[model samples]
Target: MFKNSPYTIYGITALILIILLIILFSYLGLNLYIISYLISINLVTFLYYGFDKLIAGFESVRIPELVLHSLALAGGSPAGLLAQKLFRHKTIKTSFQMTYWAIVILQIILILWLSF
Candidate 1:
């Protein structure tokens, strides 16, 4: 049981340590807002690209076409919008373009909501 479970055991231990650290920091009254924001930024980029690939299918080089509005709903819209526009890979397709812009608008609204 222990042989094949080594990697899983190590991973679980690391995850527990991280959770403990988070709990300790919060207990100590440390604010994690900034750290959370930075982590979100990084995750957004990765998620956007991943979503794109998922939506496009395996054969398409343009990446999968994930639901952009949904991603934006989850705080990854802005990154997805920027990446799609800059890369110009999925910009021309009617479905992708439309959904991408729709997500952009949604993100703007979310930003406003968060700010106020």
Candidate 2:
């Protein structure tokens, strides 16, 4: 039952696509590869949130919050926020919100520090 879930399919699809992109990007310059990786990760992250929301009421296993946060930390926080608003998922839970915001803030700081 769990293995046949749409989320599993999504995960597999995303993984395959990401791997293919990585292989393609390897032939490209580092800057281009970095950009492609970021875009892919964000797209995957957005889909993950939507999928998690879709499965919220079902008995099927939901995407773990840790995975969500890890994705955001991997540079998908903007997509995470967009997905939260678009899917109306993970916006109300105070604990989750706090942690998410913290991650965002840290990312912002890291970016600013790097830009200096």
Model 2 regions lying over 4 Å from their true place = 1-17, 24-31
Looking at model 1, which ten-residue stretch has the lowest summed lDDT?
Answer: 60-69
Candidate 1 clashing pairs, residues 3+ apart or interchain? 52-63, 52-64, 53-63, 53-64, 54-64, 55-64, 55-65, 56-64, 56-65
**Pairs of residues at least 3 apart in sequence or in different chains that clash in candidate 2:** none
- Tens-place lDDT per residue, model 1, 5-73, is 534443344345445555655666666855544345435554555555565655533422443344445
* lDDT of each residue in 6-42, candidate 2, tens digit only: 5566556667766676666666654577788888788
Predicted structure 2, TM vs. truth: 0.79
Model 2: lDDT of residue 65: 81
Give the alpha-carbon lDDT of every model. 0.54, 0.83
lDDT of 1: 0.54
Q: For each candidate, give its TM-score against the true structure.
A: 0.45, 0.79
